[model samples]
Target: MSAPTSNIADFLRWLETERGLSFAGYPELWRWSTEDLPGFWSAVWGYYGLHHVSDHDEVLADATMPGATWFTGARLNFARQCLAHTTDARPALIAVSETGDPVETSWDRLNEEVAGVAASLREMGVGPGDCVAGYLPNIPQAVVALLATAAVGATWTVCSPDFGTPSVLARLRQARPTVLVAADGYRYAGKEHDRRPHIAEIMDGLPTVRHLVSVDRLYASGAAPDQLPRPDVTRHDWTELADRRARPVFADVPFDHPLWILWSSGTTGVPKGIVHGHGGIVVELLKALGLGVDLRADDRYFFHTSTSWMVWNLMVAGLLHGSTLVLYDGSPTHPDVNGVWRIAERTGATTVGVGAAYLMAAEKDGATPAAERDLTAVRSILQTGSAMPDSTWDWARDRLGPDARLQSICGGTDICSVLAGGSPLLPVRTGRLSGPALGVALASWDAEGRPCVGEQGELVVTAPLPSMPLYFVDDPGRERYTRSYFDVYPGVWRHGDWVTVDADLSVAVAGRSDSTLNRMGVRMGSADLYAVVEGLPRIADSLVIGAELPDGRYYMPLFVVPEEGEPFDDALREEIVGAIRQSLSPRHVPDAVVPVEAVPRTLTGKKLEVPVKRILQGARVSDVSAEGAVTHPDMLAWFARFAARLGSGRS
Candidate 1:
């Protein structure tokens, strides 16, 4: 994988001449990341066609988290921009369920529905700064209600319907939402799961909620009743709330006004409430769509994500780009294993984004979409949330048509857009993220805070980007936000990704900074362990964690999921350990090899290592049980038993 000699300037020129993009599209974007960032970002707000009431003369009033005022004088409604180019007939949302009939909402109809919902909220005493909590699926109702909340100047927070009652209560308690929107039930894997009971439990726990609005999709007859009550709960049907009202106008607010409160998946501790601002989020989303993904108005954008993942927020940006958003609310491989590819073929999705885990699953299942379906409409496939293996790229090219671009995108919820990804103008590399986003100053720095190439180091952004989180909710003086990113490197945002920039300037991801195991004072990323062990035909997936023995020595424990029906024998374990020892170092060899059925993962499909470490330590693990454990829960039990055996010197 060779790095293009073309810098941001050359890339922009190629975009203009070869890609046929306008030269004036995003000059500030190219200049700010390399030159004056503040000016570049200030220009981005106007270049992206954002709607603001007043022209902001100042780019940033302060640099501190709590004191930062972006577009201080500017006043605009976030919902207005989302609804700006919408038409009456254009499909705003196309929602398909797992087992039931599909539903569609036109742009004008969606706008009207949002207005009615907003009117209902206003009538229910909901006001600005009030939180509107949603415990629903990725249905059209959720989208409409979220937009309505933004239109009414209320902050919105949502969790997927799959979340357990305790997780929902924890998030709603933190946000203290006044209005709670839920569904009667949802379908997953051809089974209808009743959410009414979960909703009741959540309402009982949250005394702050004043209105409980329920979408009637779960009713046996699909009838929209006025209200349903059980004990202290009274639910208002979503359809009944939709009454023709005068086109509800949007409320103008400052650019830094809070739009939504998103939570960090609580795999270790309580979920942190990260608040995002209007101007920064809007500009960042537009840049990601127009510049990063090169989304066009006529293209149909599809992503396999729930409301829980950050990709959902990024995918919603396509609506702002005037592209039809094709949303599927079910298992990626449900009804049949080919559900996602079938959806792509049916929708003619030009740009499709999916988590890397799904690609691995496709490889395992021997799924080939290009041979079975017409994928010519697909332009690029954006993959993130986990490191994509080289094999996944080969499978994509071989199975998903040669013309399609395979973009290895890497970013987090903290930034809202990818820091490193592929550009359409560049040639596709095997496993590396083609390059950094135009305005992102992404580089690898060593432990001594010196920039280094061809070696693994911390991934840091030297300059500020608009989409960075403004502040955490209720964090007095922004202490936590500062400590999270800026505490490690003064004045620099250290994204906790261990990466190596090769001599060719191609970046290869190691793993999370926190999860990097230190054995005998040598830092080893877990991805290195997986790359070595999982490459063997006997292994399916594995989780490597550094465990402290009772003797106070830290040792690496490897839990592997073997290929089905393959016996996990001592001979195979020796081979796995030998592979790790030879590929990495002798210290990289696992102290104990435990074969497990599955690995625990967060909602975003990231391995939950911290909590697994806690369970190994024999501490009462509560956080693991809080959020709906997506992976097989028995893996924790297997880990506990394995750890006990290792503790007793039985390995």
Candidate 2:
């Protein structure tokens, strides 16, 4: 009906004329990319005009997972690429929160600050291969610290300040960082929280920390604003480093050297520590930002996330493409559900990003963004962290208005990039991802490991991608690394997500594969039930589990948390059941509709379905639940008592 509008059309034309590519359109180019792996990635590095100190001897040396090496003999510094293209005083970073006005820093200023921070880190005796950890909010200081660590060729790890002492110690201790960076405190939801006590507990648990650098946010100037109990470790103030204005030193390292560490949510046990490299991240983000999101060099990029989320790390990579970043630290709903929308309008963000849950909440609040805010410059809105309901897509259309495309991306900490997401040349279908990311080798495999199209199965990457974790921290002998991905399908990387790919290449992701509900030999995702139940006005949240008994019988119970003082009657239950049966299938309906106080969820908003299912199927709660992993660990007690009573009753 209309011509296709793409931000990357000019780039594609350049590839055709300059690179001598014969591909005509997006489909042909996509096929060429997935088929000729080396050519596709090499074209990306070249097209992005990335600077390197030395040329790569080979594009891909070995094509093996956990063993694949990319850009052999290439020597480059990540921070250098991030700062290479920008030369003017234009804003490179805009930091905002719920409390104050947005702070803008120019590209030149960011370069100088990063150089000074890197110099400060060197003065602390940090060198190549050393580890630096950030226990801070999603502020500019966190980004500066990460870039400084990368500039020094040291590994960086981060956790949000919102985490409790146990959560902080459980993750940072495994990295064994010799240096730690944190803020004195942060403001959230009309309250101020001091991190001094939490840092004391964390430092006591981590004996390996030699240097502790504190960012003075809550207290701007003072020698004793926040004192640490661990007097043995050297402490440096963030303001002091800026005052010195020392020059930064860049390190030239191998392609596969560790750049940062991202942890699993650790709900079941100690979070799985994943280590990613510089070259892999640089190349991967170049493709993801350039082609997948079609992000421009001058565009303002914003993603609402804490430092704890993997998306925060990805947002920092916006610098790699010279995209100005708009960093927000406070709660997304601090003043109201419209906080993020205001930031997008104020920043003139070409692309805005947020978790799927945030959009759902705003839509539920009856937010009309275009009417309430100035969104003239907004072109696209990216949502990830989970599959979005169809209602989210409809709401974004009405709220953001025309020219703002809703991109529902699906990827996680495992790959550090998207598996299925936005495509400029493709149509954005409601409740469906645009398509597979270029060069992802993405496919859906059935139970017997056969690749299937138009059928639901486990999402697996059959080939190696640059951004996959090289290995896990403290996982010597590659035992955990191999078992986490490869053990499921030998060489193929089973990403643990259940997805369906249509014949036209569009993808619809189900929930986690391990948490899929099977009803009388029929398999369905738990997300499907949530898409039906949570849309109701009376229901606040829902959790469903198909527990298998020792006698091979399934107990399909649908648990719902009703709104405050809202009644849950048989009429409402039947309405929910009828909706599921009509939209999905008769087999998809739950056997029982049970009311609960609250459904258990992880701190990151993920339902603890698999772990809760494990607990219901005769496993101990201690083995299935972690203290720091859950949002409401107290809520788990209700589930445990309910599971015990299930022994005497039937759903």
Candidate 3:
């Protein structure tokens, strides 16, 4: 086996030597990659030494936006690709928890467990096209279950135990998995949550779940699996399923075979079950993580995430590069404000990825994690979920020292990979993404479908990406899929976020375009407002909502959650208004500054700007966001009450 080097460098060398292609820099390489998608993607397949049972001349068969077919004749399994790179000496997984000490799972152990579970699944009649749903946490067992499902050619989907029963059912019922694997409970914030009852409710809701596998995390060895809820349902322990001595065998399914289902945030409605194929994920992850993020075998990749979030799925792909994955199953700031940093320090994590909100809050709290912990091993600090403020970015750079590169990445669960993020060859910039990812024809397009530069516009992809969803579950006619992405631009994938592409191609993403704020004929993104508002010392968090009333009058309100003991008095409000007027513009200033207990966010830590705007515009709470999909559903009621008092008839 050939040794792994810097993947992007290696690919560039391969392009020059094998393909007779040479580029001066990343910009030229990226341009060529997008222009010749087939050549670039085929090179990725070959450079990674991907093994397939059948070969195909067509890298991408159909270039249609919603129904693009890729690598049709090739056959491979995601499990095989994930496990093939690592050696016996390297650890496959490092599982850490709030209460328990860190445990390392070797590649041999992982393969054995995967083989055992795959055999057990085959015995239970699970096969190709069968769905195996997981209501598991971020643990080794969850990894084992997903790999085993892929090994047997069964599709896999998962939800974190943190999600309530309704949220779990809302997503899982769409897939209708034949087998369900769930943990007995999970621990978070120094507390244990018994989810057996919640699991029962989930089982009752998903009648298609014929076999139930229980992972005993909170229970003892003598504990028995729960009784089957119905006569047709059978119960099995996770350990029992993984105890058999068996050899690993992978099913060589077609390249476009369903691998996994990832759910949208469901902030607007029921989450869409996005299905991605095996070859697409395998190829894309190898490129996105290996090239874009420069992940290496010696690197311990740790991304603070839950199973419900897409980052967890992306983190598992670290195994594709023979890198060890560090999985933490607890609150980011549980034992202390620097808990996550401590985890990185102890694990010797080389790459750390976390939501931007965490860094912002830590900056507000005056946290100096570098001073508190030894983070010298860290080489890259990836921030996602939302754009970071300039001040927070500066603070992070200063705190982490000069060695770590701070990268702000923006993507969605729809792709289950990065659209625009950091590349090893690109220079780090403050409060801006590096550039469009290679093989992504990303652009900022105005309403007229004209590309825009140095100005905010709809983020659109003019070409089909391999990692784009094969199809949304239950959307047989592709109506939902088309309407979701290609509806706006007609044949182009219009990601909902607003972005600005500089002449140099560095991208800056504002908040969601749908939630953009327009006042007195002046337009601005919510993220621009947040970058100013959240940077204030007195403000702990904030949300801005703009609603057009029945009389065609715009009502914009800036809701601020004051820092502890900091009141939203006239003085503070005036400061906020003055800051916006100075930093941005007087035309974009809010009509009112209302203090709130907290700002509502999705489970993944995105502010509920659009949903709250709908609530303030007199929309029903149920019509806007699913309760289970939100971090604080109770805030929806408060917003509704405030709307009621404002009255819809007000001018």
Shift of residue 59 alpha carbon in model 1, Å? 1.4
lDDT of each prediction vs. the true structure? Answer: 0.76, 0.84, 0.88
Using lDDT as the yardstick, the better of models 1 and 2 is 2
lDDT of 1: 0.76
| Winner by TM-score | 3
Task: Write candidate 3's Cα lDDT for 1-651 as tens digits.
Answer: 974566788889988998899999999999998999899999898888863445775998899888888887888888988888546597889999998778999888888899999999999999997999999999999899999999999999999988888889999999999999989899999999988888888888999999988898997631233534576788888888898899899998888899999999887888899999988999999999988999988889999999989999899999888899999999899888788998998888999999998998888888999998999999889899998889989999998767898888888899999999988788888889999999999999998999999988999999988889989999979999999998889999999999999998899998888888877756688888888888788998899988896556789999999989987799999999999999998877998899999988889999899888887777899988876888878989999888887884442
Q: What value of lDDT does candidate 2 attain over all alpha carbons?
A: 0.84
Residues 89-201, model 1: lDDT tens digits: 56777777776554567777777888898888887877787999888787777777878888888898999988877777767798998888887778888888877667767
Model 2 clash number: 0
Candidate 1's clash total is: 0
Query: In model 1, which runs have C-alpha deviations exceeding 4 angstroms?
Result: 1-32, 51-53, 64-67, 100-102, 220-234, 502-505, 548-550, 581-587, 623-630, 648-651
Better of 2 and 3 by TM-score: 3
Model 3 weakest lDDT span, ten residues long: 220-229
Which candidate's lDDT is highest? 3
Model with the higher TM-score, candidate 1 or 3: 3
Candidate 2 Cα errors over 4 Å, as ranges: 1-7, 51-53, 220-227
Models sorted by lDDT, best on top = 3, 2, 1
